[model samples]
Target chain A: MIELIQHLINGFSMGSIYALIALGYTMVFGILQLINFAHGDVYMVGAFTGFYAIHFFKLAEHPSWLSLALTLVVAMIGSGCLGWCIERLAYRPLRKSPRINVLITAVGVSLFLEFAGQLFFGADPKFFPQVLSFEGDWSFNELKINPLQVLIFVVSIFLMLALDWMIYRTRLGRAMRATSFNLEYASLMGIPTDQVISLTFVLGSTLAGAAGVLVGLTYPKIDPLMGVLPGLKAFVAAVLGGIGNVRGAVLGALILGLSEEFLVGYGAPTFRDALAFGLLIMILLFKPTGLLGLKRAEKV
Target chain B: MTPSTKIKLNYQSSILWGIALTLVWISQSAWIGLMNPYYLSIIIYAGINIILAVSLNLVNGFTGQFSMGHAGFMSVGGYFSAYITTHYFAQSLDSLSQIQQALIFLGSLLAGGCAAALVGYCVGLPSLRLKGDYLAIVTLGFGEIIRVVVLNLDSVGGARGLPNIPGLCSFGWVYTWVLICTFVIWRIIRSSYGREFLAVREDEIAAEAMGVNTTQVKVKAFVIGAFFAGVAGGLFAHTLRYLNPQTFDFNRSVEIIIMVVLGGMGSITGSILAAIFLTTLRELLRPLQEWTQIDFRMVIYSLLLILMMLLRPQGLMGTREITSFFRNRRGDPR
Candidate 1:
């Protein structure tokens, strides 16, 4: 029972990261109804930004909460700008184009970022600098928890709560909801639809950036392509949670992470990655609308 | 025109086609027979890419189904073909006559294609029900799953990969198969079945309303596309004399998609031209890496794709054929 608890806790930590990323996917999909294939690269950019920030600011020498906060702020802002630019540049022109055309452009952006990253950073993986060294652990009756896991859980929850408040309570949030509900109607009502879309990208990219830094801190290894797997899994999570539902994204991510953990624990570890994708296929087959999705009547 | 003149024109056109095909076959054979190994390798790769791009175009362009897991089918074909060739004829092929070796090669390629087609059908059945982005995600997942599964299986060398498979794919084999693939696909698209596939692409609900079995048409396209992809994979495997699951990763699928998209989706001639151009461009850019400090070819390619989508998403030829370009030049109304 204790071992199971331990595994569950581990899964929850990973799930939190996925949930954070899935929120970005869900939000963009909600407003645009287009899958942003380059969202994963944004996560990667966040990690790299945080990485460079730490190195440039010499935060490791100070090893304080303020420095960590500073690094995260820089990463978030940097990633947010990138997200905005991606929207304004690659996607805006294709607004009136076909969905598949936009999707392909998104993929092109993704490939551009991945290869550019490889070219700029080299293909070798970088070791993320640990700004805060938390060596402490909590253990009870064969159940143990590391400080890193606690940090990850605490940070992700706090950010998610802030996001929830921003989405539900802010004026921008209302505008976003209106825009997603109906862009033309929202625009007719004097809401700045384009700005709302841009804001959505900024908010979503900010969260993904935070997750990226948190993942680097916990895992301590970063690469240009590190976001690809997590990005894909989070996409699956978003789909599982009915895509546009924020709360459903969290629930779905938790399930995905837990299932992956259990599969790794019990099944052949070699099949670990495959298990998540296999689950995606199975869920898609059974519930095309996803777990929390409501089917809309098609107009013939 | 008179009936007699029409008959004469038909004979003339067929003769021209025959002459072109013969010249192509003879030239390919001569190149393989005489060219340096380095240049020969490039031509072979171009042929494989042509097959992949054209086959994928059948699904993505003609049927309007977004399939990003084409490399999965390729890997299946590669691994299966290599397995049969290595296990059954490893020793026998060494001392066999040239004709016997050619026969065994053909058999293996066919087996590989059949296996891939079967897998494609199974995957298509459930996944093809979805449209657009959902279908893309499912296919992407399937591709990744295939890669991971292949990585774990040890008998076919697992992560280490299969090496020293017999070199059965030559310039002749590649050219011949490329010819066959193009001919078959061209025929299918020009036939009534091709119209059904196009109907599905235009609008599925409308197609269904018109009594087209959209599901059956999609499955057929998926299967046929996979078969050609598998044959390409088999050719690739034999030409390289090695098989690695890693070779058919998402990047490979994307590369093929790039060709299809850049060539003008749904245009076979465009795919063929784009494949050859992109393959040659990649080779030509090899020296740029040495001269500069970075390899920017992929960067250029990605930018080109984005720019293409932003400016002209229809691609190089759009839906028009090469023959149409010439006909237009000859004063035919476009």
Candidate 2:
């Protein structure tokens, strides 16, 4: 029973990271209906940015909450700018083209980021600096929890709540919602669809950047190719939660994270990677609309 | 214009095939001996890639199904055929005559293709019910699942990869399969069945409304495409004399998809040309990569893909054949 609880805590922390990334995927997909394949690489870039920020600010030496907050802010801003640029440069021109063309271009952009990242950052893995040492653990009887896990959970939940508030309470969020509902109608109704779409990318990328830093703090190993599997899995999570649905993405990610933790804890470790895809196929087969997705009839 | 003219065209086509076969025979028997091994190997690899790209085009280009799992099918064919040759024929290869050895290799290729086609049937039957990006994701998932499963199988060398397979593949073998794949797909594209594929691509609901059995047509395309991909994988395994699970990953699938897209999705000749061009380009970049100490080839390739989509989404041939240019100039109706 303790072990199960321990696994649940581990899964929750991991799932929170997935939720951060999935929110970005779900939001971009919501507004543009294009899978921003480069979003994963953007997360990678964010991690790298955080790494550089840590070094530049001497956060490893200082180790303060202020430095950590500064690193997160820098990473988020850097990734947000990249997301905006990706939208403007790679995707905007292809807006009038076929969805397949956009998809292919997105893939092209993804590959470009990965390979170029290798060229720029070098192919070797970099050890992320520990900005804050969450050395001790909180123990309750046989159950133990790492302070880092609690920090990750708190930060992610806070970000998600902020996002929810932004989307539901703000005028920009209203514009975003309107744009996603109908681009042409939204434009006609005086919403700046292009800006709204770009902002969605920015917002999503910012969260992914935060996730990247949190992951760096937790794992300490950062590499260019690290984003590929997590990106794909988070995309699956978004799909499972019902893509384009924000709450669904979070729910889906948490489910995926918990299941993966249980699978790794109790089942064969080699099949961990396959479990995400298997769950995807199963969910898609049984509930194409996803867990919280609405069923819409196809119009000819 | 007349029955006699149609007959004359058929005669000309047959003559062209005969000339091509004669050239292939000559190249296989003698010309290969004269060529440098470096260039010879590149040519062989190009031929194998041509087979992959053309077969993939049948489904992605003509049928308009965005399958991103071609590499999974290739890996299945490769591992299965490699298993047959290594376990069954490795011990007796020296005892067998030339004819017997060739026959065994041919049999393995067929077996590999059949295996892939069967797997394709299973994957396609259920997945084909979905459309567009949903279908793409499902296929990608299946492909990843196949790779993961294969990685865990100890008999196939698992993650270490299956090694020491016979190098039975040659230029002649690869080009022959390439020719067969292209010819078969071309015939399908020109037939009434081809129209159904195009109909499904143009609009699935409209095709279904017209009683076009869209699902069946899709499954057929998927199976046929998988068969050719399998054959290509067999050829790949034999040529390399080794099979690694990593060789048939998502990147490899993307490479083949790039060929089909750049070649002009539905254009067979374009696929052939693009395959050769991309393969040769990669080989050509080796020296540059050595000098620069950076892998710029993939970077260039990805950039090219992006630019191509932006500039000419229709691709090089844009669903038209190279021969169509000549036919159109002569005012011959296709």
Candidate 3:
């Protein structure tokens, strides 16, 4: 029972990272109906940014929670700027083009960013210098739980609540909802729709950046292509939960993370990829609109 | 008409085919002579890739079904062909006289093509139901699943890759398979079935309303496309006389997709031309050796795909044939 609990906790930590990334994918897809394939690369850049801030800037080592807080705000904002710039420059002009063209461009942007990172940082995996290391283990019956897992859980819950509040309560959130509901209608209503789109990207990417840094701290290794698989899995999660739906994204991420764990437990570790992709296929065939996403049928 | 006229037409037709074949043959042998068999081997593999890319383009470009599983069919063909050639005539091939060896080699090639064709039909049966991005993801998953399953199965020497399977191919065999696949694909493109596939690309509902059985048409193209991909795999396996699971990754499938996309997707000659160009370009670019200190292929591919999408959007040749130049100058078909 304890081992099961421990595994569940581990899965939850991984799932939260996926959930954070899925939110970015779902949110952009919600408003624009574009699958931003580069969203994963955005997550990657966040981790790299945070890594450099600590490693190159010589931030204090394992600082108290307060000092660590400053680093996150800076990292999140940096990531937000990057996402905002990408959307404006690479994506905005192609908005009127065919979906396939946009999709191909998204893939191109993803490669460009990843290769850029590789060129700048070199191809070798590097450690994300740790700060606020908590070395403690908790045992309940027989399950060994780490302090890091608890931190992951608490931080994710707080962020999720904050995001929920933002989406449901804030003025920008209302603008976002109205835009997604009907872009032209919202534009007529005098909403600064373009700004909202850019802000939506910033908000989503900020969360992703935080998630990337936290996950990097836990995993302790970072590489350029690291985001590709995780990004793909998260996209599946968004679809599974229903893209354009926030809570659905979270629920889908948890399910995917657990299923991945289960596959690791029983199947060849290599087969986890097949398992996740297989689920994407099965879910699409059964529920094309996704579990949480409300279907908006196109006019013939 | 006199018998001489009939003989002249046959002679002209055979001459055209012969000239084409000899050109490819002489060029390949020239490659073999200029560099060791190592470079020759690379060129042969590149031709095999052209076969895979051109076939895949029919399903992806003409039909508008995004399938990233080219490597799956290739592996299926690879393993099957290897099993037949090695399992059946290993000792006979090893101990036989020259003429017997030659006959067995011919049998193996036919066996490989047939096996690949059979699997194509089986796989294509399911493709009838899938469309768009949904089809792509499924195909991608199918490719990965095949790789894992092959790695696990020990009979075909799974993870280690089958090596020492008898290098039985020459320049003749390689070019011959390429010729057969190219001809078959080109014929399909000019047939009534080609119209149906194009219709599916234009609009599925319109095609359905127009009494075209969209599902059956799609399956036919998918099956034939998979068959050639398989044949390419067979040729590849024979050329290398080796097989490994790693050789057919999602990346390899993506690479072929790139070739088709880089070449005008619907233009058969364009895909063939692009395949040869990109394959050679990639090899040639690998020699930068820290001078420019860049992997130029990725940047070239990224820029080309992005630029084509942003500007041309429909690749260089689009659906127009290369011969359309002369044909257009002469007159319209009507």
- Indicate which candidate wins on DockQ: 1
Question: Against the true two-chain complex, what DockQ does each candidate achieve?
Answer: 0.73, 0.72, 0.45
lDDT of 2 by residue, B53-171 (tens): 99899889988888889999999999999999999999899899988989999999999999999988877886655777777777888889989999999999999999999988888
Name the better of 1 and 2 by lDDT: 2
Q: Kindly list the per-residue Cα lDDT of model 1 for residues B1-334, writing each as its tens digit.
A: 3567547745765566577678777886665578888988999999999999999999999999999999999988888998999988998898999889999999999999999999899778875568888888888888899899899889889999998899988887887788778877877786666899999999999999999999998889889999999999999999999888889998889989999999999999999999999999998998988787677877888898899998889999898887678767877565
Ten-residue segment with the worst summed lDDT in candidate 1 chain B?
B1-10
lDDT of 3 by residue, A179-242 (tens): 8888899999999988988988898889888887887778889998788888888988988998
True contacts kept of 3: 0.41
Which segments of model 3 are wrong by more than 4 Å? A297-300, B1-19, B22-39, B86-92, B97-130, B289-294
lDDT per residue (tens digit) for residues A1-300 in model 1: 887888888899999999989999989998899888888889999999999999999998888888889988999999999999999999988899999999999989988988899888776899999898666677776778977777778888898888888778888887888888788998999999999999899988998998899899889898888888888899999888888877778888989988888888877888887877887788788887778777741100
Find the 10 residues in a row with the least total lDDT in model 3 chain A: A291-300
lDDT of 3 by residue, B60-161 (tens): 888877777889888887787777777777767868887777677767666666666676665565566666655665676778778887887788897898
TM-score of each: 0.95, 0.97, 0.89
lDDT of each: 0.87, 0.88, 0.78
How far does residue B221 in candidate 3 sit from its true spot (Å)?
2.5
